[model samples]
Target: MNYQAPLRDMRFVWHEMFDVTGHCQHLGLDLDRDTLDGILEEAGRFTAEVIAPLNRNSDEQGCQLLGTEVSTPDGFREAYRQYVDNGWASMTGPMAYGGQGLPQMASACVHEMLMAASLSFRIYSGLTEGAVLAVHRHGSEALRQTWLGKMVSGEWTGTMCLTEPQAGTDLALLRTRAQPQADGSYLITGNKIFISGGEQDLTDNTIHLVLARLPDAPAGVKGISLFLVPKILTDGRRNELSCGALEHKMGIKGASTCVMNFDGAQGWLVGEPNQGLSCMFTMMNDARFQVGLQGLGIAEAAFQGGLAYARERLQSRSLTGAVAPDKVADPIIVHPDVRRMLLTQKSLTEGCRMLGAYTARQLDLEHGAPDPEDRRAAMRRAALLIPIVKGFFTDVGQEVASLGVQLYGGHGYIREWGMEQLMRDSRITQLYEGTNGIQALDLVRRKLMGDGGAELHALVEELSQHVEAAGHQPRLQEMAGAVSQRLEEWRALGKTIIEACQRDPQEIGAVSVDFLAYSAYVLLAGLWLQAAVRAGETLTDGTGESAFYQAKLQTADFYWRRVLPRASAHREALLGGANCLMAMPASDFSC
Candidate 1:
C-alpha cells in the first residue's frame, strides 16, 4: 500500500489533543472543524496520489547539473507547479501578500504530509517558506513590495545563502562581500556551498537571502548582513550568480544541493546592517522546526512501510501459539521481537507527532496570540522546543527508520525495498539545520540562559497541573506519577546544569546532548501522559472511539514503562560533569 497521510491522527492531535480549532477561532481564522477536515483530506489525497509515487524514482534519477543551471529530477517541476497552483505554497504566508493567512499549525500539518510524501520535494518549498518569513518579518517595505507577492504566489522560490567553503556553523570566518553601489543596490560576491535549489527549473526567479559582509564592517558574525539577490533581477534579466556544481550525496539527491557562486550579484539589504545573524536566526528557527517535521515524516513513512511488511511477511509462529494455523509459519507480526520493534516505531512516531503538534501550537500562539504576555510566553516555550523538535526528533527518527530496516532483515539493506532510503534521508535531518550537537549547545546557551529558565519553569508547572488532572483516574495514576517524578527530576537537573555552567563553561557543551535527550524523554513523558488523559476522558465520556483511545493509553504505558527509563542514563551521564570529555586531548584521540 502507498503511504496514507495519517489524516485521522492529524485530527486527533490538532482538534482533540491541542484544540487548534478554538485557537484559530480566537485568532479570527474562522477555520471550523469541517473546513479544516476538508483541507487535510484534500491535502492527504494530493500527497498520496501525486507525491508518493515519485519517491523511489526521484531518488534514482536525482537532480542533474546541466551547463550553468541545475535540473530537478523528472516530475518534480510539474508536481511543484501543481503544488503552487493549488495554493499550498501560501498556506501560512502574510495576508498582505495574497496568502491564506492560516496559522502555522495548519501549514505544519500540511508540511508533515508533504515531508512524508517526498522530503526532496518538500525541501524546495520549505526553503521558500523560510525565505518568505524572513522577507515578511525583516525586509524593508520596498523590498517586501517587490518580493513578497511573487514568493507567496509561488511565481518565485527562495533560499537563505549563509554557508561558505570555510564556514559551516561558525559565522565568524565568513568572507562573502557586499559592495555598496551608487544606485542604492549592493554587489554581492561570494560562494555558498550546499545551496538547496540554488538553481532549479521550478520557478522563473530564485530570491536568495545571502549573508555577507560590507566593506567597512566588523571582523566577525556581528558584521554579517542579509541581502536579497534575485536569480533573475527586477528587470527580468538573469543575474550574475550561477550554479557552479552540485554535491553528490547519499540521499535527498532529488533536491539540488548546489555550489552557488554570486558574481557581483546586484542586491538590496534586509533588516539592520550588521544584524544578519540575528535576522537569519529568526528564519533558522522556522527552518529547524520544519526539519524536525521532516524527521517525524520519515519516521511515519518507515513505520507505515515496516508495519505493512510485518503483517504480510511470514517467518515463525508466535511464542505462545500458532497465529496462522493454515500456513507453515505465522506472519512476522505475531513474533514478540517484531511486535516490539513495530510498537516502538508506533510509539515514537505517534508520540513525536503529539509533540510536534504541541510545538506548532506554541509557534502559532507566538505569532497570532493577541495578548502581549501570552505571545511572549509562547515565544519562550517555542524557542526552547525548537532544538528538541529539530534534534531529538531527527535523532530518534534515524533510530525508527533503522528499525524499519531491521524489520525487513537483509532485504531492507538494498535499493528495491525502499526502507533504506528513509534511513539515509533521515540521517541528514540530524546533520543539517545545525547538527543535533549544535542544537544541544544552542538549547544550553540560548534558551536555557535567556530568561534564567523562566520558560522551563513554566513548562514544568504546566506539566505538574496535567499530572494533577490525571491523579484521580485509577488507570492513569501510575503513568501520571511517573511523569510527575520525571518533571521534578527534569527541573532539578536544569538547576544542576546551570550551577555547573557557572563553574566551567565547557560543562555546557559537554552535558548539552545528554541534557537534551533527558529533556526530550521527560517532555514526551508529559505529553504521552497527557495524551492518555485525553484518551481516557474520551473513553469515559462515551465518545465511542474506543480502539483509538485504548491504543493511545497502551502506547503511553509503553513510553512510561519501556522508553522513558532511558532518561536515567542521560541524567547520570550529564551529572558526571565535563571532566570525562574535557580531559581527553584532541591530538591524542587520533592516536
Candidate 2:
C-alpha cells in the first residue's frame, strides 16, 4: 500500500494553528497567502511524486557494503541533488551562508513532507543541517569560509559522532582520543558506532563533528572536546579516510549506520578544549524535535495506510442491515472496535503534528523574534515542550504504527504491506536523540526540579490564561479545562516527587519516565486545544475550509476522549513511588 501526503491536514495546521502569514509578516518576510500556499503545494508534490517512490526501493535494495566503501540505494544521490537544487536544504540555514533565510516554521513543512515520504533519505540532509548549524555558530572564520557554503548547498554531508559502544548515553565515558599536533590539527583515533550516514556514496566527502578527549582534559563530561574530521583531508586539499563497516539494522536499512574507525585521522578542533559538549549541544534541542517528528511521520504514514485499507476491506456483515448488503460482508470500518483503532491513530498523528510544528514555531521565535523578552519566553516554552514532542510522540507513534499492522490482520505483518517497516523505523526514535526515558528524567530532574519547578509553574500559568480566554467556545473550553486540570495534577505530583528526591536520590529515576509521559500528554492536549479554537471558528462558517476545520476539531476531541484519559495510569504509576524499581536486588535475576 502506498502512503499519500495528508496535505490538507498539514495546511490546516499551518493556517489555523500557526497562522503562517501573520507569522511571516512578524518576521519581516513579505510572503502573501498565495506564496505560502504555493510553497506547500510544491513541497507536497515533490514528496509524494519524487521522494515516496524511493522509500520502498531503498528499503528493499538497502545500502551496499564493499570492503571499506559504502553505497546508498539507487536514486538517493539524484534525489539529494534535486533536493538541494530545489533550495530545501538552505531554507533554514543563515542568509549569509547562501541560505534562503526562511523561518524554521516554514522549514517544518518541508521537513514533515520529506520525513513522511522517506526518512532514510532525509536523515542525511537533516544531520548535515544540524552539523552546519553547530559549525556556523562556533567555528573559526577560516573553517566557515572553507566548508559552510558547500554544506549549505548539499555538495557535502555531515554527521555527529558522540556515541561509542560503551558510552551510549553517558558521554563522559567516551574513549575517542584527539591528540593535538604542532600545526593546530589533531589526530583522532577511536571506534564510533551507530553513526547514521557516516559512510555513503551520495556525497563527495562527509564532515564528522566528533567528540573526543584531549590529553590534559579534566574527567567526566566537562573534559570532552569536539573535532571536525572530514573523510577527505584538505590541507587546503586531499582525501584520506576509510569506511570501516555498516551496521545491519531492523529498519531504515537504506541509511548507512556505520561503525567508523578513525586511525590518526586528520582533524580540526571545534570550540575550546574540554568544551565540546556545549559546542555539540547547539543542535541537541532541535535534533530531539526532528527525531520526534520522525515518530510523527511514521505514525502518520501508518495511520493513512490503515485508514485507506479499513474503508475498503470487507470481512464480516454488520449486526444491523449491512450498508454493503449487496456484498458478502460490510467494510471492516463498520465495526466499533476498528473505528476506535482508526480514531486512535488519526487522533495521535494529527495531534502530534500540531505539537511538533508549534514547537518548531516556538524555536523560530526564540531565535528570530525582535524582542529579547519574547525570545527568552519562547525559549523557555520550547524547553517545556521538547520532552513532550520527543517522548509523547514516540510513544503514540509506536502504538499507532502497531495498530495499523493489527488493522491489516495477516497482510500487515507481510513485507509487501510495509506496515512492519514503519514500526521498525519508528522504534529507534524512542531510543536515540536521548531516549524517551532519558528525556523524561531530564524533564523531572533538570528542567522541572532544578529551578524548584519554577519553569513548570510559569508554563502552566501561561496556558491557564489561554484556558481562561477560551471559555466562550464550549469545545475549546472543555479541552482546555481538561488540559489545565491535568497540569495541576502534574504540578502537584512534580512537587511531591521533587521534595521526595531531596530525601531519597533514587526516587527521581524511578518515577521520571511516567511523569514525563503524563506531562507530555497534557502538553500536546494544550496545543491541540489551542488549535481547536481556531479550527472550531473556521468550521462554524460552513465554507470549503469548514470540513478541514471540523476534522481538526474532531481529532482534538478524539485525543481527549481516548488518549488523554490514559494519563491516569501514568499518574497512578508515578504516585506509586519508586519502590518497585529500587527493590530489584542485584543478584536476584542474574542471567
Candidate 3:
C-alpha cells in the first residue's frame, strides 16, 4: 500500500485550528507559514521516498545482535545518516545546541510522517529526542555542554533506562544501584528491559539515561536517582554496559528492544539525587506525546490502505443498487458496512491529528511562552490532555487498525497487504509510555480528583466559550450546541466519578478507563467541531477546495452521529461503579 502524508489536513490543523504560527510569534519565534510548509514538504518527501520503503523489509529482517554489537536492518543505518544530515532531528532542539529550534507543531507533523512511514525506524530518533529533552532540562551545565551538542546533531543517540526486569510500572520495586566514586561520577549497575535503541549501531555512541538508587538512599521510588551512562567513555574506552539479549517482540522487529546490563558503568547523575522519577518524567512525558503521534500515524496508514482497497476491490452489489454498473460488481466502498468502517477510521484518524497538533501547540506554549501565567496554564492543559492523547489515541489506533484488517476480509490477514503489520506495530503503543491503565488512573486520581477538577473545569469553560463564539455561523451553531451539551455531560460525569471515589477508593480504578475514554471522545468531538467550523467557513466563503471542506464536514457529522455515541456507553459503564467488577473472586477463574 502506498502512503501519502496528510499534509493538507496537518496544515489545516496548524494554521486554522491551532494558529501555531501565531503561537510561535507570541514566543518571539519567527516561524511563518511558508517555512513550516517547506519543512513539512521536505520531511514528507524523505519519509515517503526514503524511509517508508524500508518499513516492511526492515520488519522482515528485524535487528540482529552478534556479540556486543547490534546491527539495524539493511536500510536503517543509511536512513538515519540521511535523517541527521538533513537536520531533521534538531528541528525542535535548543538553538544553542546546533538545532533549528522550530516549534513542536512542525516537529509533530514531521514526526507523524516518519512514524507513518516506518515506526520501527522512527523509534530510534524518537527515543533520542526524548533523552535530549531530559538531559537538556535536568542535566548540569557541564553535562549539557558534553552531550547536548552531539545528541542535537544526531551524532550520538540516547535511551531512557528506567524499567528494570522486576520493576515494570512499579518503580518502587526497582533495585538498580549507583555507587558514587571519588571523581564525582558513579557506577551504574542495573538490568533494564524493553529499552528501545539501547544498543543500536546506528551511532558511534549511545547515551543511556539510567534510573538507579544510591547506596545510602532511602527505599522505594523516592530513592531513585537519574544517571547518564554512556556506552563509550570520554577516554574512548568502552563502558561496562552491554545488551544481554534482544527481546523477541510481536512487533516493531526492526527496532532493537534490548535487555541492557549496566555492570558498574561510569555515569554522572542528572538532576538531584533521589529525584530520578521526576527527572525521568520530563523525558517520559515527551515520549508519551510522541507515542500518541505514533498511534495517529499508524492509524492513518491503515486508513489510507483500507480506503484505497475499498475503492478498488469489487464485492457484492450495493443494497441500494449497483453503483459501479460497468464493473463486475460494486466496489466495497458502496457497502454501508464498509463505509461505516472506513468513516470510523477517517474520523478517528483526522480527529486525532487535530488533537495531537493542538497538544503539540500547548507544549510549545508551555516551554516558550513569555508570560509565566501562560506557561502555567499551558502546563496544566498539557497535563490534563497528555494521558488522554497517549491512551485514547493508542486505543483508537488499535481499533482503526483492526477495522482496516476487517475491511480487507482475507487479504488483510496476509503479510503482503501490510495491514497486519500496522496492527502489530500499533498494539505496543498502549502498553508502553505508561500503559493506558496507568494513564487512566493518572487522569482520575491525579489530574481530575487531585486538584478538585479545576483544570478540567477550566478546559470545559474554554471549550464552551469556543462553542458560543461559533454560534453566529449556522452550519457550526448546531455542532457547537451538540459539543457544548457533551461538555456539560462530561463535566457532570466527572463529578459523579469523584463522588463515587470518595465513597470507595476502588471506584477510581473501576471507572478510570471508562472516564478516560469518555473524556477523550468528548475532547475529540470538540476538536472535530472546531475543525468543522473552520472547514465550513472556508466552504462558505468559496475560498478553499469544496471537496476537501465537504469531506471534513461529513467526517465531523459521522463522528457526532457514530463515534460520539460510544461515549454514552462509557458513561453508563462509569456509572456502574466497582461493585460488578469487584464482586467476582480472584480464584473463580481457575475452575
Worst 10 residues of 3 by lDDT: 469-478
Q: Please give each candidate's TM-score.
A: 0.99, 0.96, 0.99
Runs off by more than 4 Å, candidate 3: none
Could you give candidate 3's per-residue lDDT for residues 277-327 as a string of tens digits? 999999999999999999999999999999999999998999988888898
Between the candidate structures 1 and 2, which one is better when assessed by TM-score? 1
Question: How many clashes in candidate 2?
Answer: 1
Question: In model 2, how large is the Cα lDDT of residue 397?
Answer: 78
lDDT of 1 by residue, 21-127 (tens): 89888777889988888999999999999998988888999998889878888999889989999999888889899999888787788898999889999999899
Which digits, one per residue and each the tens of the lDDT, describe model 2 over residues 7-46?
A: 7877878886678889888878887878888888888888
Order of the predicted models by lDDT, top scorer first = 3, 1, 2
CA lDDT of each candidate?
0.91, 0.84, 0.91
Candidate 3 clashing pairs, residues 3+ apart or interchain: none
Q: What's the lDDT of the predicted structure labeled candidate 3?
A: 0.91
Best by lDDT: 3
Clash count list over all predictions: 0, 1, 0
Per-residue lDDT value at 249 in model 1: 96
